[model samples]
Target: MIISAIALSLLLFAAGAPAECLGEWSPHVVWHVAKIGKLTSELQLGPNGLLYALCGNKLIAVDENGNKLWESDLPDGSKSGCPVFDARGSIFIPGNALIQEVKLNGSKGWSFKVYQGSSKAAALLTTGPGNLLYMQLPTGLYAVDTAGHYKWMITQWDQVYNASTQLETDWEILASVGNDQAVFVIIGKKKEGYTLMAFGEGGKIRWRYSLGEIKQANLVVGGNGRVYATVNPKRTDDYYKGTVYAFESDGDGSPLWSYAMGCVDLTAPTPSEDGLLYFCADEKLYALNQDDGTEAWYEPLPKAISRPSVDENNMRYYLGTEDKRLLALNTEGRLDWNLTLDGKVSMRPMVGPDGYLYVVTEAGSIYKIKDEAPESDGG
Candidate 1:
């Protein structure tokens, strides 16, 4: 009989709970070693089922057994951010002034020159419809086709009021693509304000919304064409006061709902398949209803949590913490297990295709944890 995720979690928790209440559930480590160089990006599972790791300036692909498949050196010997894969399975690596496309077999494809005469690197990379690639820079957004040819570019800037000169402020652009292939970006002007914009076909502006004077903000596009942004209060004394705002993706930025969260240093909100949003801040994990931003549940953590990875089939999520521990939580926001690692975990845990958990530590060690119980040896 198939047990529900909550029931399975309870059974596992009872079987694995320690005397100290640390919830230690030690899964068999398939492999643990510092194979890659100082890891600088979160591990990503590609469509080909190989684990892609960006370590320093090298991009390495490894199989489930930790066997090296191939490796490629990035341009300028460094990466500005994590790489993204297109619908055709080509990996796009962002660098200063260029975005390089690499094939799965470790060969180089065309390099698209996104910026001219500026040494500034791309802040984010995402894929859009029609096999198009989107790159966000401090100044503008560029859309390129699969062959690395420019489709369109958006360079318009909005004025932000600041004490200093009303100069064009460099924006921290956070971008994500929706199910409809529309590109959504949240522009956080330095010490000024925030703006949300949606780009449709031919890079046309579909909608724009202004969030006045937010100290920090992050954006995510939901499956149903809704944009969600978590904004922190701008005042230094009100650091813990934050809000999550939901807006229709296509309209004139009309609000759907807003939820107040006593969150400090909030991570990006992650949307699950069941219309729930998950985020962590101030050593607590919260689940909110995506339709109305109502509280679903929350659980406190021993340390600050990183971004979580959800397994939809099993209805569970995994996250790492600053205190060198990996945690697995059920959909009900209950702790299922926790395992202490060698070093602090700064990135989200990656779930491989074969149901193995892959994690990397700040000290550069990579580990693969089994997701299922091991078979018993007959005594």
Candidate 2:
């Protein structure tokens, strides 16, 4: 993944150019909160519209004006998962064998023990409908309600697979759908030599798909209500290869479609606007039809380190390269403009709803950059 460092440094360099101009936009820094801390996760927008930054065991909330509101300590230091909010405006954070809630005032609120005898945490926390919470540990998946009452739990995966192992598997709950049929339903995929499984309400195993032939897998839920998996096969080549697989989010059976690429894509398939899936492989950009996994097109470019982030207002794509540079690609898969940043973009440049680009660098600074282009005025 780090192989593109030198080649990417020489690629396009442009500031924030007008959305109309195909060339470049000179970068205009609106405001930046510099040297915040060792940022552990991407900046997440809180329910009250404040920006939440998770730094190890601490949580900091900052307002839109780059002013710090409050800083609080978490029960356990987390290396993954962003803070999620419930309907009543409480924050849910993950920790060792437990889930902690914090009120809007930054005071620690309630706690729920996910596992009876475990201290190891997967550190993955997600919220579903009715303020239902989902927590992932190395051992299993558990759910709790808004009042911290335990709901359902799934820990018998070895029995689900009809295979036993004393060692714990890191199971990530991918994109989920919550409705009448289930409180929070999910289709999950595990790492190297992975297994795909779908679980509905009460931790019922709806279906499972075995993909023992692959070496790695990533799952993303698309806007079209289906789960997409890009798996890499065990190979002897220099490049890591991945094929895209599509599965219905609510269905009980087989994958709808699969598309194999001739080149290599080590990242998960990025779902862009207008029903397009974008991925970079071997200095080339490829787009696929999200519904059927058909190749819409492919174009050459500098290697990409991060998946593309779609600017919904102007319909453009932004991606991070290996040499701390940001590249912009037009909707048609052509280079539009790029920008050089202070450090390897710790997180992909996110196009904010307020029409500014929010970027974080390795030095733990959140940069608010002007996004000049838009498909329509006053977005």
Estimate TM-scores for all models.
0.83, 0.80
Which 10 successive residues of model 1 have the least lDDT summed? 10-19
List, residue by residue over 1-379, the lDDT tens digit for candidate 2.
Answer: 0111232222222333222335644345556676667677667777787777888888877666666667787765766666778669788887777788988768888898754343454456766434578776656768798788888776645365545544345544443333333323233344444567665666676676765545546666677667777776676244434677788767874889877755444456678668888766665667888878888998776646665678876787776676666677776778766666666663557777777777766766666666545443422
Deviation in angstroms for 48 in model 2? 1.7
Residue 157 C-alpha lDDT in model 2: 50
Question: Global lDDT of each model?
Answer: 0.70, 0.65
Give the candidate number with the greatest TM-score. 1
Instruction: List residue ranges in candidate 2 displaced over 4 A.
Output: 1-26, 116-121, 129-131, 160-192, 213-216, 233-240, 262-265, 281-284, 374-379
**lDDT top scorer:** 1
After aligning candidate 1 to the native by TM-score, how far in Å is the CA of 345 from where it should be? 1.5
Model 2 residue pairs with clashes = 15-25, 15-27, 16-25, 16-26, 16-27, 17-24, 17-25
In model 1, the Cα lDDT at residue 123 comes to 52
Which parts of model 1 are misplaced by more than 4 Å? 1-26, 116-119, 158-169, 174-181, 233-240, 373-379
